[model samples]
Target: MRYAVSNQPEGATFQVWRGVLAGASASLVGIGLARFAYTPLLPAIIGAHWFPASTAAYLGAANLGGYLVGALSAGALVRHARPATVLRAMMLLATIAFIACAFPVSFAWFFVWRLASGISGGALMVLAAPTILAHVAPSRRGFAGGAIFTGIGLGIAASGTIVPLLLREGLRQTWLGLAAVSLLLTVIAWNGWPAQDAPSSPVNEQPKAKSPPAPALRALFAEYGLNAVGLVPHMIFLVDYVARGLGKGVDAGAQYWVLYGLGAIAGPLLSGHLADRAGFGRALRVALVLQLVAVVLPVIASGAALLMVSSVVVGAFTPGIVPLVLGRVNELLAHHPAAQKRAWRTATTSFAVMQAASAYGLSFLFSHSGGDYRLLFAIGAAALGVAFVVDVVAVARSK
Candidate 1:
């Protein structure tokens, strides 16, 4: 009866929409304004002032590194801190960093700011997942989680679309404007946020622990890390692979990007909902199959129709898997409050580690392979195949 329905009224249904919006806005500062905007705007910033490409890449990586640390800290800290409070602090840090970029600081100073932004970005993502899902009933958590992940894609798309238009205003102005928007979003999150789900404790009280061994949850954390590797290829390099590897022009690449983003936005919610009804494992298998088709289609057909189809298929399933994965992680740690904290900490740390690995792998592959990314696509397809197997095995064993 734990997952049984309550005799609630129409107004008492799952808060999936609200959770998704909160997730989107929270994610915008982290994924869009802070983390993602830098990619497109970097060229402009470099052009405006001279900086070596290596230094810029390093600075960018610094942000990712910061995310790793922040995620670990937030996962444990969320047990003590209210989710809204943590999100607000992270948002504030990200906003300030964006505005600070306008000041034209020294290379060392810029790296520090980037690091701060990265930390906030990581924290925001980890906190948002659970915070949003907690608002929904347990039966609906999968759908809610998937819906919430759409926020990340929305943020990415917004950054891609907005930064290019704002390039005319100069990087400094754009940075300031992004900062202002972030601050406004933070305020909205503060007012609308629900009460914290963690146990209450006084300032001098010890952090409470729920009954359970930590090792079980730690195993789930390792699985999360593996899942991260499974997800990276389609996300980070899909656009470049389509453009350079497939011989499409920039315009075609942009179109494919739009398609993929749209898929990312839509896929999670649909998959999550389906996962809830059909079982998470079955839903995941379905998504992975579609994603595989998306990955491999370009190997044969490089035309616009196939390219767009590929983007959409890949996009649809890409972000959707996150919610399902987190839901499973949550199931493992449900009995122990302290365990939840530890598990989240592990999830965040693993997330950052995976992202770093994925980025490095893509860069190394491209560098050594003379920018031919077909092999990269093949590798991605293979990884997903393995992930599909894992999902099947996990589900079958659980049953």
Candidate 2:
């Protein structure tokens, strides 16, 4: 079923673009600054003695836990308030979390704020694209959705570049700097959201009968969850792997992160375009294959050039998979706006659960196994391999 777009008066295109930007800003704050920025800062926080290594690691995990909570609750929150209201509030909450983190008054205090930021990120991830895409023409959603998620990549890139510069000033300054950026984005996006009453679906599109998700959707959920696990090694350990594992030092690690950030920035746009040309299903399979190769590359070849390739490819798929999964949800549930939202929430929650589990599980393995980065990457590769096989078999069986 083809999704429908609402009719609009003259100049609606500009409003749609504005809404897309607002959605992007929400993602940047929630995922980019709120989540990704912490990675580059983790070593600095540990090095500064703000908290012991164990405490600091747990604090990092706090966000993932909070993300799960937010994903679980976003639908309820939206039911009570307009999507715009919830989105704006979440963005503000994330900004506040950033400011509160600058003090480090206590581990509990820092953990609460980190967790709050994670909550905001999770809600934003769940709601932003779906909300904005509702106002977009169906024909443009592939690109518009990609444009919205570009915020995540922007956030990743900022963590690599801007966060490093801020760290030079002091930890407090870095947190404050992030807060400032978040605030600016919040304000810019404030008026970008469409009216609360904007039509959820095209007028002529009839609501479909509510039913259990099809097999293809269940397969997508598994694929997305496993993809999260596959991403853990790079998301959590890429910097450390390049800096310490490879004995390249902090500066070298940051450089590799920058490369990762660059790849992330390009990944969604490229993938979205591919989805538009081929199909979300086909695009997703291709992504899984590329990701599998990238994750295993480090384990097989440790050369600088190969390492760079690995970083870029994995980084691209990090946030890149979001659009493909989202598009697939819409494709499967076309003409069912309400169902689309529910499916997306389920998918987001599954992703958060897998990501948090893999992070702690892999971290434990890394420590107990004497910092074996290759072992972690191998595990990640295995997860991707399973995801690819599952997707292929599911598609084949459906036929």
Candidate 3:
């Protein structure tokens, strides 16, 4: 079960890729299936009379609340358990959550399981890439990080395509099907993690009360949080907007979701390659600009072609921004893995907090404004604009 760090060329390459697969599996199950699968199912759940609209919406938000909890506690959990152990546990927890969700015994029951799924996702998000990347060579870490996050895209793609097909059978069957897939992935990744913890460096081994995070790191936290706000509109409402708001059928909305999934699949690899070639800072800035435009596209124009573009572009950046921000953290804290983990954790927590707040806030706004999808998109675009400006100013000041 142990994948010892190997000295031989082929052995090292295999080991790195194995760890990558494990990390990807964790992301795929934890974030992709656990968090996103719920989105496509939201309407179905409401339609089937499983829950009323308001309760169903609150249940969706429960995951976000639990995610914030997970992000805040991931480090402490790792301190008590091996990263590999923690990763496996979280994956199992996600699988269990999926199974538990099939019953829909009561509002409280669904809420608890949904929240647990989010916790699994948040913990995996915080821990997976950094742990796996710790064993990868620095020169190749960008690509490796991107590969790991591809699981998220894969999950999204599956949610769009597979969930709808599964819905044909029944909601309970769909949940069970997802659990089967998650369990299979969990088994595949069971032994791919490195056997030992990442080697500690002098920088991290210093006294606990070291200097505060650098200014750039601080700015990154804010920018990342803002990016979360920017993404909320599409993440929460894309399918709904297309299907309900735009007067398109659910099938058409699913098609748009599929396109979004396609963009997501390409986004991380492209962004990672860009980070390798151009640097994480520049890659992040470019991503922000692209995301800003994508978010605003719907507001400016809602043609079929333009809506498709918005879906794909915004979808690409949804999960795409993750690797960029993670890479930027690594770049900023090079040779300081512990610090990088801490900074990444803080960034993730910030993202989760903002995402949860914005999801609810935007939902409230949409409800109050008579389900104004354009207004939601406009607000998201504004958030991205602010994030881009903040990042630019931070980079200038750092220079």
Candidate 4:
């Protein structure tokens, strides 16, 4: 804890440790952990009741929809208030949303609850990036950001591992236990991430002040939005591609996910270090191209060896690219405070919207194509290729 706190910046002394915990906990409970629990837990939940599989899936789509709403809400609200306060409040909302899962209800009600949870959780994720980066030293931003986002991976893995074990007890008991954990996470965020006043604008006194207009905002949104469309098929479908589509068992799929998490942990740390040395934009472009290659693996190979290799490559590609994207966005607007804010907001909100679109598209594809994941995988590969081109153009234009 002391080591983690040492690199935390000045003005962060009283609150840095708490902020990390708050950010990490908010990620764990708000979006990654709580929101994703539905997927792994769905089998157990459905086994206990006799609901249609499609209806259960609707709950997921509803959550993504709520996430889009929450993300937009956070962007609008954060401009007027401190980010930490927004993060804490959203964490509380997400906790309650997760708890909503504990009760047995009709599919329609489940959809509503999930939508609320997604909106809250999405805001929580958006709030976290700025709140953590704003307080940290510029030199340490990438590493700290990586450490912070890793919480999402941890939370997601925890939910995956826990949901199955809890089912051994009973559906109600399983959900109750998860709800308890989410509540604990909420308490941590509310208490640990207490708000601090934002520093006064450093450039307000200068005569050369510039602010981004609607045109700039739209441009940033388009760049980030297209990038996100590429990630959706991969991030949302990786597990299913390995498990159901490839004829592998659930355990093997879980192992592949675990490998992904391990790659996630390693990739970010290494990418951050290298980005500092090689330049963020260049490094990020290389990484995106590599990911494009990784996404195409499923289409060419079907064995365990290819699957394992793909897991490692995709794992390294996905989360590793996040910090760099945010860092570049931060760089692009370094001269304009307002542009910086808008860039971050656009990046986040568009991310959620793209995720929802990806989910809906994948679900529709899976339904109609007679479960041919190959078409979806091909789509994912193409999106990644498009992302590479978009990123190159965006980076060049910014320069």
* Top candidate by lDDT: 2
Q: Where does candidate 3 stray beyond 4 Å?
A: 1-14, 200-213
TM-score, each model? 0.84, 0.93, 0.93, 0.87
Off by over 4 Å in 4: 1-13, 79-81, 200-205, 209-220
Q: Residue 177, candidate 4: how far off, in angstroms?
A: 1.9
Local distance difference test, each candidate: 0.70, 0.88, 0.88, 0.69
Superpose all Cα atoms of candidate 3 onto the true structure and report the RMSD in Å to 1 decimal. 3.2
How do the residues 1-399 of candidate 3 rate in per-residue lDDT, one tens digit apiece? 124555434555336778899998999999888988888898899998999998998898888888999999999999999888999999999999999999989999999999999999999999999888877766677778888998999889988888989999999999999999999999999988776766664555666644544888989999999999999999878888988988998899889999999998887878888888888999999998999999999898878999899889888877888989998998888756657888999999999999988988998999899989999999999998999999999989877
Give the lDDT of residue 268 in candidate 1: 74
Question: Residue by residue across 1-399, what tens digits does model 4's lDDT show?
Answer: 322334336544435566667777777676666566777777766676736676776776787788778877887777778776677677767766666777757776677778888877778767786666666666676776666666666665665677778878887777678778877877776755535533534653466755644444455456556556666665677788777887787787788877776666566666766667776667777776777777788888888887777777777655566677777676656556445655776678877777677768877887899987777777777876776776666556655
Of candidates 4 and 1, the better by lDDT: 1
Q: Report the Cα lDDT for candidate 4.
A: 0.69
Candidate 2 lDDT over 145-248, as tens digits, reads 88889899999999988998999999999999999999999999998876554464553265555454578788889899999999999988988998899898
Task: Give the clashing residue pairs of candidate 3, or none.
Answer: none
Instruction: By TM-score, rank the candidates, best first.
Output: 2, 3, 4, 1
| Candidate 1 lDDT | 0.70
Q: Model 1 TM-score?
A: 0.84
lDDT, candidate 3, equals: 0.88
Backbone clash pairs for candidate 1 read: 263-315, 264-315
Clashes of each: 2, 0, 0, 2
Candidate 2 Cα errors over 4 Å, as ranges: 1-14, 197-204, 207-213
